[model samples]
Target: MTARDEILGRVRKGVGKGDFAQRKIDAQAWLTARTRGPQPALAGDLLERFRNKAESLSSTVEAVADRGAVPAAVARYLAAQNLGTEVVMTPDVAALNWIAHGVRGTARAAADADRVGVTACFCAVAETGTLMLLSAPDSPATVSLLPETHIALVDASRVVATMEDAFALLRAERGEIPRAINFVSGPSRTGDIEQTIVLGAHGPCRVHLILIGTSS
Candidate 1:
């Protein structure tokens, strides 16, 4: 047999005595009963806390009254930054009227030439101001990774209190975890050179978060 098959065979022989179905159920129960360790008590609303923490991590934050205002806000941000109007966005946010607000958004993987990219996070964590993104056919990771500027649209309702809470929501909503789960705190930075910090050393130079409170 092949090396991979041989290794698998040996592993199975060692632990294949019990009922796999029962083991799976037991493992699931254990996961459900898992408890989180001590966490820092954070006050204030989740959205505000998330915004404040994100800003501390060097991410710019803005809040919108509703989802319909997103495109205009994006345009305003681009204008303020003097960035190109053309953007690569995830399909999830493609419903926004980008063209009406003097922006062009293409739903696809970001190319090397793409300067701005827009995306929507699966969920956000208030404890660390971290964003969680699950990879899918419509939500390619590249849209958030390869651009000079990355803008994420977050729904206030999806904000979780902590990392553990975020994972719990993930497990509850998506029974099977995706192949890629990305957690981003802010812009890509590196302090590896003589302890001098540099932005965009490995990825996007800037990260902007737009929190949507309501869709109506």
Candidate 2:
């Protein structure tokens, strides 16, 4: 048998002997021993530190609610660019009424020449102005890719403290294992060739975030 198959066979045999529970207990004990310090509270200095870290990772953070015709603003921004009003919007964005803003929509990845892309962020980070979009049925991640310009509509309520917090939330939603999770910090950019930072090298060059807030 292959080495991998033999290893799996051995694991199966060991698991049949009820060793998995003992292993789990041992692992838990090891983890507890490693983290013996008391947990910090989520306020004041701790919160400030988290806020600072989040800002460093995010591109453009905004705080807002889903109300206030935010979708209209997204559409207006696209129209102003004379980009594709008939954009391939992410499924999350399609849930909103883009009709009010005079835009047709699709979920397909836009071509490089396409004018605009609209998407709803799964999370917004207040510390560093960043939006997080995860690929799913309603939010195809490719919508954020493949476009020249991308517009993200984020709700203030969805803002999180840090990437760690964001990953925790993602793990909760996806269980201990996930297929593909993409974390977009800002517009796709690279300064590799001549050390001259160029945007839209591998993905959308421009990223505009529309923060829909009940109280900014």
Candidate 3:
């Protein structure tokens, strides 16, 4: 017998040989099963808990009436921060009339010079105040990673109580995982330098979230 086959035979014999194919099939079935484990208790209003947790992480949150109101809110934020009005956004949100609000919007991946990036999130985790973004053709990952400032638009109805709920939503909606899944809790920070906290060490220094279809 071939060396590989001989080794496998020896292992099977020592372990009391059984149906290898059936074992593989059973393992696959178990993986595909929608089995849930014990989760922590998360109470109270999900949206309110999400807002409080996000604010605690130093992320600015705003409530907008609908998708059409996003541009004006973005413009206001930029103006308030004395930042430029030009932003690179993912194709999913590029259809909004950003120019009418005195902000220029480019629907493409972010370039090094792009200071701000705007994209729509797949969901938000209320437990940790995290925004979950799935990367796809319409939702380029570069728009959120390469910019100095990241602005996310989350639908209020899409907020979930925990991370497990977010994953379940992903499986129910997308069926399979995307190329990349980003969970952004807040602006990037690092405390590795002499134990001193430093923001914007690896990613955006500022993160802003606009909750659509919610009252302020």
lDDT (Cα, tens digit) per residue for candidate 1, span 84-138: 7999999989998888999999999989999999999999999999999999988
lDDT of 3 by residue, 1-216 (tens): 899999999899776566878777776688778577888788888999999999999899999989889999999999988788889999999889898999999899888999999999999999999999999999999999889899999999999998989998998999888999999999999999899988789999999999999867
Least lDDT summed over 10 consecutive residues: which range in candidate 3? 13-22
Off by over 4 Å in 3: 8-28
**RMSD of candidates 1 onward, in order:** 3.6, 5.5, 3.3
**What TM-score goes with each of the models?**
0.89, 0.68, 0.89
Considering only N, C-alpha and C atoms within 3 Å, which residue pairs clash in candidate 1?
none
Mind giving the per-residue lDDT tens digits that candidate 2 earns over 1-216? 999988998988876654778787887577546633353344544333423443454434343455657667666666666675677777656666767777777766556665667787777544444566776777777778877777777665567765556766765776543445666667787889889988788987677666566434
Q: Which ranges in model 2 have alpha carbons more than 4 Å from their true place?
A: 1-65, 108-114, 174-177
Better of 2 and 3 by lDDT: 3
Clash count list over all predictions: 0, 9, 0
Give the alpha-carbon lDDT of every model: 0.92, 0.65, 0.92
Q: Candidate 3 lDDT (Cα, whole model)? A: 0.92
List pairs with backbone clashes in candidate 2: 55-127, 55-128, 60-129, 61-129, 64-156, 64-212, 64-213, 65-212, 65-213
lDDT-better candidate, 1 vs 2? 1
